[model samples]
Target: MTRPVATKVAFEDGWKAADTITLDETARYRRRMVMTSDNGVEFLLDLGEARLLRHGDGLVLDDGRVIEVHAAPEKLYRVAAQDPHHMLRLAWHLGNRHCPSQIMEDCMLIRRDHTLRAMLEGLGAAVTEIEAAFDPEGGAYGESHGQHGHHHGHHHD
Candidate 1:
C-alpha cells in the first residue's frame, strides 16, 4: 500500500478524523513515522522535516483523509509562586537547567522530578502534582513554530 504524505496542516475545516493519534512531546516531532490510529488504521506521517504536531491539528493525507493529533497526558508538577517575580525566577531556573516547561498565566508546569520538586519547594514555590498534556515552549529557534504554528526551516535530523 502507498503511504500518504501530509503536506499541509489544518487547524479547522478539515474532514473529521476517523481516528486519533496521541503522542508525547518527544514522539511528536517527526519527518517520517509509521503510526496506527485509535481505530487501528495504519498511516505514514511524512512531512518536510521533523516538526512538532499540536492537538486538534489535522494531518492532511495525500489521499484526502485527515488524521487528528492529540497530546498525550503526562505527569507534571504545577508550580506556583507567591508573586509574579518569583514565578518568573522559577521559570528562569527551569530554563537554566534545560528543562522543558509549560508556561501558564499564573503557574508553570514541568515534568515531575524529585530533585526539581525539592528545588521548587526550597525556592518557596507551591508544587501541585497533576496530570495534563504537555506543550512546552519550543525554545529560541523553534519558538516561531509554536503550539499551533508551522515551521519553515531546516531541522537537524
Candidate 2:
C-alpha cells in the first residue's frame, strides 16, 4: 500500500482528526519527515518550509484525513519570581542567554539546563523542575519555530 502524505496544516478548529501524533518541542518543528501517528499509522510530512506544529493543529493528509498534533510532556524548568517585576528580570536573563522559554503571566518555562538552573538560583529566582509541554515564544522576527533570520547566516549553538 502507498503511504499517506501530509502537505498542509490546518489551524482552525472543529475538524475531527483521524489520528493524533504526540511530539516533543524538537520533533514538532519539521519541513519534511516520516511520522507515525499514536495509533500506528505512518505518513510523510512534506511542507513547503519548516514550521512549528502546535497542539490542536491538524496535519491534512492527501486522503482528506486530519492527523492532530499533540505536544508531548517534556522535562523543563519552571521559573518564578517574588513579583511581576522580578519575573520580568528573570525573563530578561533567560532571553539574554538565548534560551527558548515559554513566558507565562506568573512564570516562565524552559528546558532543563544545569548552568541556567544555577544562574537562576543565584539570581534569587525560584526554579522548580517539572514535566510539561514547552511552547516557546516565536523567533525575534515574528516567525514561529524559532528560526531567526540573520543577515550573516548565524546559527544558534
Candidate 3:
C-alpha cells in the first residue's frame, strides 16, 4: 500500500491530530522524508522547502489527516549564570560559537557537549545535565537565509 503524503503543515489551532510523531532536534528540520507516527502510521513528509517543525505543529496529509509533532526528549545541558547580565554574556559566547541553544528567562538549554560544558564552566556558568525536549531559536536570519540575500552554513568539526 502507498503511504499517505503530507504536503502541508497546519499552524492554526483546533485541528485534532490522528496520531503523533516524535522527533529529535535534528530530525525536526526536514523538507522531504518518510516518517512513522508514534502509533505506527507511516507517512511521507514532502514540503517545498525545509522547515523547522515545532512541537504541537501538525503535519497535514493529503487524505485530510493531521499528525501532531512532538519534540522528543534529549540529553542536554542546562546552563545558568549568577545573574541576568552574566546569563547574557554566556549567551553571547554560545552564539559566537554558533551553538543552537534554547534561551529561557532563568537559564539556557543546549545539547550536551564536553567542550561546551567546560567552556561554560570556565566562564562562570553553572552547567547541569538534564533530559528534556529542546526547541531552539531559528537564528537571526531565520530558518532560511534566502530572504536575507545570503546563505550562511554551519560546520561542525
Give one digit per residue, the lDDT tens place, for model 2 in 1-157.
Answer: 9899999988766889999999999999899999999999899999988888876778999999999988898999999899988898888899999999887767889999999999999999988989887878877675667443212221111
Please report the TM-score between candidate 1 and the true structure. Answer: 0.86
Instruction: Return the TM-score for candidate 2, rounded to 2 decimals.
Output: 0.89
Clashing pairs in 2: none
Model 1 bad stretches (over 4 Å): 13-15, 143-157
> What's model 2's lDDT at 10?
83
Q: What is the lDDT of residue 119 in candidate 2?
A: 97
lDDT of each: 0.78, 0.85, 0.85
What is the number of backbone collisions in each predicted candidate, taken in the order shown?
A: 0, 0, 0
Question: TM-score for all predictions?
Answer: 0.86, 0.89, 0.88
Give candidate 1's whole-model lDDT. 0.78
Model 3: residue 120 alpha-carbon error in angstroms: 0.7
The candidate that wins on TM-score is: 2
Residue-level lDDT of model 1, residues 77-100, one tens digit each, is 888999999998999899999998
- Provide the lDDT at 147 for model 1: 48
